[model samples]
Target chain A: MDIKDIMKPENMVYSKTPVLTSTTMHYCPGCSHGTVHKLIAEVIEEMGIQEKTIGISPVGCAVFAYNYVDIDWQQAAHGRAPALATATKRLHPEKYVFTYQGDGDLASIGTAEIMHACNRGENIVVIFINNGIYGMTGGQMAPTTLIGMKTATSPYGRDPKLHGMPLKITNLIAQLDGTCYVTRQAVHNAAAARKTKRAIRKAFENSALGKGTSFVEVVSTCNSGWKLSPVAANEWMVENMFPEYPMGDLKDR
Target chain B: MAEKILMKGNEAIAHAAIRCGCDGYFGYPITPQSEIMETLMEEQPWETTGMVVLQAESETSSINMLYGGASCGKKVMTSSSSPGLSLMCEGLSYLAGAELPCLVVNVVRGGPGLGTIQPGQGDYFQACKGGGHGDYRMIVLAPASAQEMYDFVDLSFELAFKYRNPAMILSDGVIGQMMEKVELRPMKPRWTNEEIIKSMPWATTGKTPDRKQNVITSLALDAAVHERLNHTLIAKYKQMEDEEVRFESVQCEDAEHVIVAYGCMARICESTIEMARKEGIKLGLLRPITLFPFPKKEINRLVPHLKSMMSVELSTGQMLEDVQLAVNGRIPVNFFGRLGGIVPSPEEVLEAFKNSINK
Candidate 1:
């Protein structure tokens, strides 16, 4: 077969989702953000909800998530995305409203908003990206940072008595009666990406069904902030992060 | 005509919000303004008018909720007291920076820091000046009566959407707690989604193929772009100052001394003017209805006809500074106030006025 014929539409096995803007992503090479962004865009496109989805971007690294996602977006102040989503979903019950938040934004600065919003059962999806460190502000220790993990602020490793334990906010959210679907997934590999995409689609469906808040926590990687090669960061996340976070559905009611 | 009903100022706010076709009311409970949310919850507008009334966990959450609704081109509002309003400053700055239209009612109490629940105009500077960070101005309306409280909700929403800027009703504890006969406006219908999408092209009603995706944000990474945003906001504020200045002048046409006040203080100044008239002292009162657009031109107009100007407030010379700025040393500007939640009596104001004239 000719190369041109091989590159034709019928022969194509995969294509980029049109739900994403043509603008280049700012995520570093091997960063899980790009993969997660791709999954969200793909799911929105696949479901034909590109015109019905409103995204709330957080104040952390994914603050520019609005720039990459070709949807109507509202950039909230720090951890206030859930609060913003709550009102957006309440005011526009017919629309699909979701928030994309980083660990520092969701677990640290915005803990109150996240907890109350979940408790209220706002009927919105919360896409929590947990990378175990603050990626945007030069890898500072995050709420999800392991007890012995080292970062810019925790140079001597995180101590329980000093810095406290890693916050498993996803598990806490799963315990909330208001959350109808709560799952923790990853997008480090092709299989994992497929699994995460399925989880995202289910969460979006749950929102439309008016089941309540659907939380999908993506255990991601921050290669640049982790100060490791992209491949090494994935390895580190799999070996270190997966053990603590663990994959699979915590709650699916 | 809608019949008059005796209502508390805070309750009037709730009734007016529903009647004005507000799409949502997100607020936290606070003194002098708790009646707003309580009344909302009791009325259950969600069943009738479909107005979403939610009591948020905090003032921070409620203000951000308003930001959410307003971004979708909804007529949303929130009410709080001095301390609660203080907590909302960050959200207010974000709303202004994003240039989203919404209404905020602050039934102000005394405060430098959790001061008192009594009436005080100490927040005059905070409201008329920037309450939060950045160079931004909100359309501020001061309501002296329960009627004005009911009336300003619609007016505030109108100006808010007109300018795509935040509008505030800067009421105090006195007006909020006081009961007066208020003539309610007929109920207005809430807009449909299609109406919003058509009227507000910049709203985040999700992406459509025909138009560009709307992004509601206050973040500007580029320094030059941020500066341009700032310039745009300043120009909008300049336009508001030119076209939105609102005030009421009483007896200033033939007077030697003019008293300048706003909100509840203006009501008390009416009595002061009456007392001065009996004593053969021609005292006039210039009440500023819009605190931000600030009747500066009116104050300037009174400058030539007065021997001296007295700024009466519930704070220590906050609005007095603006009056002085308007006068610009053309005549003497005097200040009289009772601090820490004291609403000075008319006799007290009369003595202060007499002292100012004697000085």
Candidate 2:
């Protein structure tokens, strides 16, 4: 139980990836972003591609993702990370390029950018974090907000006629021929987090293989935005979110 | 041996950019400037110079793509018309704030909103002033001839990377569409990854174990820090004004009236000067090559010799305000312009100059 005993490599079964910066993240307690960022860092470290990976960070809670990840980063304008990633990959075809974007950033205003990038079959990876609500702007209804889900923007529960149905952007992108791999995973639990990490690793591997765009959607939870406890949020995601966005590979090639 | 070829202004820009060793081109076609990407595509310079050419979905995506490539310390560029450029204002602002170096060639066409596809100099205000929202400035190079279009492509990138600020080749429909003889420069090779890292230490060229990760961003949340960032940009502008002002003077040494112009209209006013000389009207011409710097000192120097000054343009006098500000009310600086894609003839321009002098 001593510090030296715990510090030994053989004694330690788990440790943070060096690819993750020591700088603290601003994600709320139990936020899925921290988990995903860690997963990506671990995978990048495992692949020994940390020196050649570049990230395009989106505008949202994760806008300052550059601070948390120890890799070259380009902070793209809101909803424009995919477009930015396209240029990065095209310019340096040898490097691994990926975009980390939120639902509001990808599914709504940036719909055109993502669609065209995917349709054009840009050799890049797109990591989409879809939590049912906008976290950064304070509990607003996001494009992936569930029906009958209440938030600041939809205080009286989301009405289908009023707010329209939540967008299944990953499913939509999966239909595009440009996307070689499309998968929906989660980070709410340990098993789900492991699966999401594998998906992210595969996406990066696919990009290196020049296999066109690879998309990995993480159906996450926003406990603070949902006004629920962290434990409750995981339970909520299991009972509610999983049915709408089932955790599995929707398409693969 | 390098060859001299006949080419359109837009094509000249494309060829010159390739010869200048541009690493990438992301553009969406717009009228009067579509030839830039078309020429690049036809050349397929990727096979030779390793230049990457991509036809983006829209102007918005094209500019953002430049933002990404420029962030990576690559020589990237994009070209578009007025309406398309309007769609890129936000990306331009981001580029400015992040201090990313890149070239933007605006083959200007008429516009307030999709005004026309014909030539216009109405974007003078947008290019000279901070086109987007923020306290920032970009090097605005106005090229008159198809040859200048070829020359300024390399020069614009040089100035852009020198100051880590965006530079624009502010051509017009007339220049973009008109053909002329161009002396092509010898081809240069694209920058290798090592060369990029050596030149742009701040560029996000991926992180190695020895080097820290680089980030290209403009977001500063703290009020004090953001204000200091604005001050840094302001100082850069002052430095550029002091060192980068460029212009051409024709017959300013012994003349009574001076005609101020730039881009395609400058070529028009040159003819007007000859016609006015025959009419016994001693008119000189001051053509600004750099619009943002405004050739203020040159205009002020010519202020003492001139009886009056007038700005001639293809728009409703967008550059006139700069000429007036340069003169600072020491004498009258009038304006003559043709709106809605009208190119003024030499006779009518001379008449307008005479009318302004008489008034």
What DockQ, between 0 and 1, does each candidate earn? Answer: 0.93, 0.89
Interface RMSD of 1: 0.5
For candidate 1, write residues B1-359 as lDDT tens digits.
76999999999999999999999999999887899999999999999999999999999999999999999999999999999998899999999999999999999888889899888888888888888999999999999999999999999999999999999999999999999999988889999999999999999998999998899999999999999999999999999999999999899999999999988999999999999999999999999999999889888877887899999999988999999889999999998999788899999999988887786
lDDT tens digits, residues B194-218, model 2?
9999989998888987888898999
Q: How high is the lDDT of residue B185 in model 2?
A: 92
Q: Write the per-residue lDDT of candidate 1 for residues A136-250, one digit (tens) a residue.
A: 9899999999888889999998899999989999999999999999999998899999999999999999999999999999999998988899899999999999999999999
Q: Which candidate is the best by TM-score?
A: 1
| Local error of candidate 2 at residue B120 (angstroms) | 0.5
Model 1: lDDT equals 0.94
lDDT of 2 at B161: 92
